[model samples]
Target chain A: MSREAADGRAGTTVGPGPGTGTGQGTGTRGRTAVAPARARHLRTRLGLIVLGSLLVAVVGTVVLVDQLFGRAQRASLVDLLERDLQRVQALVAAGTLGADFVEQGAGGVRLQFVSNAGVVLLAPDATDPIPLAPTPVRSVTGERAELVGSAAWLLPSGLEIGTIRMALDVTEADADRATLRLSLLFAGGLLALVAGALAWVLVSGALRPLADLARQAVAVDPARPRLARYRGPEDEVAELARALNVALEAIAERQQAERDALAEVAHELAAPLTVVAGELRQLASAHPDDPRVRAAREAADELLHTSQDLLTLARGELDRAPDLSVVDLAAVARGVVDAYPGVTFATDGADGRVFAQPDRLRQVARNLVRNAVQAAGAERVRVAVEGGAEVRLRVEDDGPGMTPEALARVFDRYVSGRAGGVGVGLTVARRIVASFDGRIEARSEPGRGTVFEVTLPGWSSQVEGESAEA
Target chain B: MLVVEDDARLRGLVREALEATGHRVTAVGTGGDALLRAVDGGIDLVLLDLNLPDVDGIEVARRLHADGEVPIVMLTARGDVASRVEGLYAGAADYVTKPFELQELLARVHVRLRERGAGEGAIERAGLRLQTDVRTLWAGDAQVTLPEREAELLRLLLTHPGRVFSREDLEARLYGDDLPDSNTVEVFVYQLRRRIRALGVADPIRTVRGKGYTVL
Candidate 1:
């Protein structure tokens, strides 16, 4: 069931999630990731920067071209108007120029001779004089606007004759500039769009190697140590791959050392225990009637039991977070209490459901029941499960309860106040409960007996199917 | 009995205990020596520790299994389920976690050796249990002490209950390369018949006509 839930969480899609460009394995394996997600923000940020730069380049080019076109148009119009005016001024001073010169145009330069007082001297129907200006104005001969340049008609002398004005039709130049700007705008937009799309594609592919690294990391078994495979270029992703492999190795070596240390402790513990057990049995056989030898044998057995519990505590396998599951605490308690003869089990208010490691929970239940029956000399004990926001387990024993001083150190390691009690059981139980993020407490009176209660954070039974989806 | 363990203390204790039980024990402290001894071919049962210094204990068990029909009992302190399962999977007949009572290990060894039914000093089958050291036979609740020749003849028949041992073949094993006379095997077989009747187990040994005898 846990494997199914993990598979469900780390769905078919691996690698970084789309659009997010995060190397968090999509919704994949992120929930159980050992190391932090790599390449999470770089891809999206780089793509955005590339696309933004392309867009800015496109817009800047359009505005610059528009300004240059405007400058070129003015220069060309001024050159055309001035050259035609020179012709008209020379002809008029030579006393051979006529208004019919406008009909003989050069490059659509319509020559109009206007008086220095700013009137159209050749227009017989004209009544209003135009303002004196060397700029484009109203056109003639099938056009609306023209480049009109006006000057005073002067001969060989520097005397100003009637002001001569020349006009050039600019309708075609304006139309051509419009066409160029329109195409530039269209092509620039297309280039920006393609560049942005290409950047997004390239960056999304950049994190593929990271996804492969994540997959390899997921498959690593701590029982066996190995390095992750990497054959990519020496870039940022390669750096990340190297870091990840080093991290895996460091963790593997630490765990291996811990296991070796634990095994060493077991061997060290087993040697003396083995000697005691062997010697105790040898003595018991020689003096079958001696009660001291029998007591020594019992002590040897308790020593073995304590050694086992010590090893369990030292290994700390149950302390790791990934082992937790949705456990039925009531069910675990029932399985434990069924073995002890005088214990009565009941579900008082609710079926206790908690999210914890099932193996550790079973150990906790066993320790409590053993402590009550054996340590307190309780012939009959009542085990109950009550549930609210927290699922609480209560074990009540009708034995000679402890005094306040004894109760103060009950959970301490090797602090047994009663005979036939191996003092490590309560300590192991307390550590196991604490690992589940729970609380354990006891209440007792000298004659009234004792009540030991454990409270674990409850998992709502209604959300059973939700975890399967996750 | 063959005891193979790496730890000096454990190896010593196991060797001393098995020898104290009236069994000849050959003990070694390494897998290399164990495989060599298994090849020597007098071992009945092997108490192999899984945590060896040179070769993996599982690999040793596999090699020993390939060597012959000797049963291997895993004796180690690694109590995790995976190790237990792996040990059993590697052709081990039984596994006893360490910090164990020496008596329990002895009891388990006794059972394995009995099932193999080739241990020289102790043999039990068909309601007849022979303690070779004492040369005594017990059938149901009754006991009968046997003479040397009768004990040797009874042990051979009880080792293989259904198979018939001829008179000549019995003489060869009982006298051990000494040429005993022809009626020498018959005199012991005749003495073994009276002891079977005294033990009160019916069909203890059958005398096939023209053949020798067998325990049924």
Candidate 2:
């Protein structure tokens, strides 16, 4: 939409211009935008949870069983001590109470007796005046630790004679309990390891679909935005995929609607703009010396550009695939250059046939040539189309170039170098080119003219049914 | 060639493009008409659009391919991957999505016409006659059985004698997505040379460096 506004649709008055605008990431591989790192963390969190629960369970069972076994062993030891004291009492009642019972340490129980006269007698293995203490206390520890019991020795006449004390060694039982606790702890640790490994495998299996879904989601082209229905069981993962697919459908529908509206606007505006521009060109040429006529034409041209850019911005978030075709690059460039008499066009190679969508190709050519003409004096603007293994379209402008800083960000949207420049024109061109399997770049130096080079594979690059493009 | 489409405007465009390329095109606006002309004969390839008024394009494709006499190329508005695969399975030799470029469509039609006999006879070119039914080429008193790939390549270069095909173009047509080593094109050319030489005929294939391969 420059120079009499004639290039908007050129000769076509009511064309729809299929690839009007959608300067978004138009290529097929738009990442799913489902934060990959966050989805990966889910696997780790699930695995840790499973491992933690098994550990808690294994350790609890071991400690509880150890406590119960220890208590039972101590209770049996105390009962054995009491039984030995009863035997001593029977001897005393038979009137055969001799030192032999105490000296023999009968029944393998240590015995001690006091005649109620301060006389202390001890078993052979017992120390003198065995310290009075409760039996089977948990803190008890010695080479000969015992469960000790004591009772009063009475005669048949019902008179208390002496006190008898009996003790049984608990060293063997304590050793057995120690061994049991050691084994229980070892088994508990082993069980926990095994269970943890099992949990890891189970979690990985259950969440396999999540990883698959993540990959599939990333591969999904946001333009079409469809995900395959999960064929597995209808579990949480399936539900999540369904939810994402639903959101994708909504996004696709909204995009389709916006594109439809903008396309309608483009179609509606293109016809009138073409007719108006066509008439203004005639009027300006007829009255070449009339400043008023020239001014009116420029204003109309600027208005067309503004409206077109506005329509493009409105459809900025949507991406539509273009209609594929074998285009003549030289022909398209020649048409754009013809609009400006000052710009020179040149061709190289025999044929300039390249596979692309024609409407988009025209739009990009117009943007590049227009930008070049505006930068340099129209006389210094040169456009060339080279045909080969790859088709090349180069537009060069010998204007006061840009700073290295400006050159680096030239393609960035909103980077304007001059007044009345819609900075996004170049960015839009790049997206359109990329959507058709082409590349575009700009090279410039401080004092040198800027060269915009676009490389698209020649149509001859494809032979027959061998093209892998979808 | 037969152009079958429900949309009148699109049908007109396809017919005009094919005719401009000098193919005898019979343009129709429904599946029923496409079937009648196809069975009646003289049609080499059918350009069938999937959305038709009378019947499903796939069903029409099956009936057309039932006798295995004619090959079909589908023009579908469904650009999704599954539909393309489904169309191929239904016996279409190839497909071009809707909103397609006219030039690309012409190129595809050109290739399909060469691969299958565009008319009902042996193709005669470069002092060699290729019998598609027997998959063999007769050169003077000698005959050599052409492998499938060689036959496809030979037919393409033979049909478009003046057109130049770059190595990249040859590779794409021969291998689709399965690109082999870098020397694949050279190897295939060498093999074609031997086959022609063994038949006691001068090689017709010539290489245009930095451009492509062409047959004179």
Candidate 3:
């Protein structure tokens, strides 16, 4: 509407200019008109209902007063005029038709008495130059004749006399009508303001609890949110809060149950695993000369070690994650390489370090190395680190890389290529990485080798010096 | 030798293993038999189970030690450190957990016998010889190295001086707790008799009758 107004205004002045009216002024006004119109449209539905009702009440009051006062004032004036007519009739009957007598008999009214010949018989205080006309008389219809509310009478001698004309003064009544209109308008406006203030108080009071609940929900941490039930009402808003609280509690309980089960199972398995490993190690030592026995014993030992790794992973998932220390990635890599020499392990980026639990990182390296060795020939594994704000550790093998489907599912629990395992190694590794807010990704093509990239944040100031100790 | 175990299968297996190594082997399923033989006065060695049906193995071991200087090697379920420590503290000479290799048990048995031999003497046999008070032994003067358990057996034989000691007599000397069944002491003696022969000497410890033994 503003745009249209501006365009209409400009069209008259500019005589069809190229861009002056159409672009800048019209665009600004066009946008400006939208906000207030939207505001007004909203207001009319609510604001106007209250304002219009108040206005109707005020106007109705004025109209009612006018009808009542106007009628009452007119009746009073007619009564006074009737009295004047009666007094003039008596005076005429008595033959006191003198002007001085008429002046003394009429009270404050400008009265005139005329004969049937249309000549004024008596006049009192008639200052105006225009002569007063007798009230119109009809010989046949003689009930009452009034010209502007005057009465005329026919005397006994057939001379029509006692024609009285009086006027009502309404200066005070006019002033009172004006005062009534002003007061009604003032009272209506005051009522509207009070209604607006009342509406504001009611709306805000109604929404205060909801606003508090909304603030709490916004501040709720997604990872560890604890929503409490609203116990105040069985009403709709309270019911919504109650339902949300129930859902949050269910989620928290399930997560806690999973953690507890994982911890309990891991603890149960550890003792048995330790015993089995000890037995196997002893058997191998006893029959050092028997290669077949040694091989069997070594296989059993590996299975035991794998079980330990699974336990470690389960424990880490249950918030038993160890406090981290800064560890030299190069040193840990070299240690794993030395321990398992059959695998030709090489490390790059010896200068790089990372802040992590040393034992856990060792487990991660061992798990990745074990997986790589299983897929590729153990001799072709390589570990590389790239330094930055985050340290990236890459373990790659020349083994057949996985299909995209396998890569996607690799981190899922109980997924493995290794024969006769719980198949939890990769899953555990991923969980450990996630605990540190790090990420592990596997890239592979069918014929090419697989590469696992793990990136973790570098050391904070406290962990900086710990790399040397590790 | 005396075998003390609650399980019948394990008792039979232990008796067979020890008997195959060539001693009169006696096996009992309770600590009561061990206590009986311990009072009878001539058992040579006790292979006691730390987990017993009749008495607490450690308590039985302590009682047997109170009765006499009987060498006891405790056999238990393996790697149960608490029980093993308890057994040792209760006067058992050695503690070994179960599923143990027979060879490890035999090695412990031999060490206990040598320690006993160095402690006492005056025992002689076709495979073992003892000189009492000097606490030394000569198996044909080649100086056989016997572990404490075997030496203790020869020493007991020498103390009786060729009186043809019965399995019960040897059991009483070795296990001071309740005796194993009469055959348990026979098994350790057979093993002792064979290893002594391997050292080229007459076995010093002899089996007599239900009456007992004396060195002639």
Per-model TM-score versus the true fold: 0.53, 0.57, 0.39
DockQ of model 2 vs. true complex: 0.05
RMSD of 2: 11.1
Q: Which one is best on TM-score? A: 2
Query: Rank by lDDT, descending?
Result: 1, 2, 3
Better of 1 and 2 by lDDT: 1
Q: Which candidate has the highest DockQ of all? A: 1
Query: For all candidates listed, what's the TM-score of chain B alone?
Result: 0.55, 0.58, 0.54
Expressed as tens digits, the lDDT of each residue in B1-216 for candidate 1 is: 888898887788888899999889999989999999889899888999888999889899888876776888997777554565466456676677677768768877886777566546678877778887798888877888899878867775775544445565565446634568779887776667767766776546655433345554
Q: Count the backbone clashes (under 3 Å) in each candidate.
A: 1, 4, 79
Grade the docking of candidate 2.
incorrect
Tell me how far candidate 3 lies from the true structure as C-alpha RMSD in angstroms: 26.3
Name the runs in model 1 displaced over 4 angstroms: A1-40, A91-111, A124-130, A134-146, A153-161, A169-172, A207-231, A275-470, B1-44, B50-64, B78-91, B101-216
Question: Worst ten-residue run, lDDT, model 2 chain B?
Answer: B77-86
| Candidate 2 pairs with clashing backbones | A324-B101, A325-B101, A466-B176, B166-B212
Give the least accurate 10-residue stretch of model 1 chain B, judged by summed lDDT. Answer: B207-216
lDDT of 2 by residue, A302-322 (tens): 555544544444444324332
